[model samples]
Target: MRQDHASCNISVGSADLDLDGYGNIMAQSQQIFDCGEPLALDIDEKILLHGTSWKNANSIVCEGFDNRMCQNAFYGAGVYFACAACKSHQYTCNQHKKCCSCKCQRTVIIARVALGDSYVATETRKKERRPPVRSGSSGTYDSIVVKPGLIKGHHKPNQVHQEYVIFDREQAYPAFVVEYTL
Candidate 1:
């Protein structure tokens, strides 16, 4: 039996009713909602019950699986902007607050590329003019170049760069170009 609360909130859980073999409600109690606050639930994953809170919260981190039980949110200009890294299925347009309508991860990728993939290349080479302090640190170094591509010997973590046009000494810009940077 489905009982509507004050609004559209439909509370269901072990405390709300006693379920029998035939999916029948055998009893009712004072408690409601598997957990009072928002939560994530996985199949074959057990959730210990008490009053209105979860006994084992597991972790605050939200893996791909945890996103299922919660509503999807876009990159908002609120507290979400404070995060060092926030991956949403929606593009984060700083200039405009309008969120691009997207369905899956690929949609987000296309949106991101359209919004900020220009001046960006995915492949880079670090030609060592001279050997490094270590022995095996010379020759051409291959790297996945991000924006503002690093040169001969200047690369750091979390540093973005802008990629310019391509040029080959004696041939075209290579036979193929593969981009995989994010």
Candidate 2:
């Protein structure tokens, strides 16, 4: 984690970029991430490694490619290279007798490689299931309510969780964002 108390300079790489032609730009230097390895960063300060995007920006916001999901889900320091293919399913049910409801669910795989050896990363997706319950079912239950009855119901939610070793930089990517360190 980098500190916000000081300002540091970093380099941006414009892939096949020209002084006149604008293209996807990313951080080019490995030094930034290398120095951030030992620092303990808060959630907000992590932005130094992760770039940002704006709806108004014409070019790719995070990586050279325009991925709204990836741009909005920026974390750690690196660029999104590729994503795995996925499919989705929708189901309609009536359990509460209040009304009919439908849900659309899908699973997607995303990958990012940070610059430098100061960090290591692995992406994971977890799927959770809950058994349907009667109308009186209460307590801490996560599920889409269905028509009031004994009908068993299930819902699938896809979540992305990533773990990184901050102090280790054997397989990290170059850092683009920089902040002053002690």
TM-score: model 2 vs. ground truth: 0.16
Q: What is the C-alpha lDDT profile of model 1 across 117-167, one tens digit per residue?
A: 111223332332211221232221111112433333334543232211111
Clashing pairs counted in every model: 4, 21
Instruction: List RMSD in Å for every model shown.
Output: 25.2, 19.6
Query: Highest TM-score: which candidate?
Result: 2
Sliding window of 10 residues with minimal summed lDDT for model 2: 83-92
Error of 2 at 146 (Å): 35
Clashing pairs in 1: 147-161, 147-162, 148-161, 148-162
Model 2 misplaced regions, further than 4 Å: 1-71, 87-118, 122-182
Error of 1 at 121 (Å): 4.3
Error of 2 at 153 (Å): 28
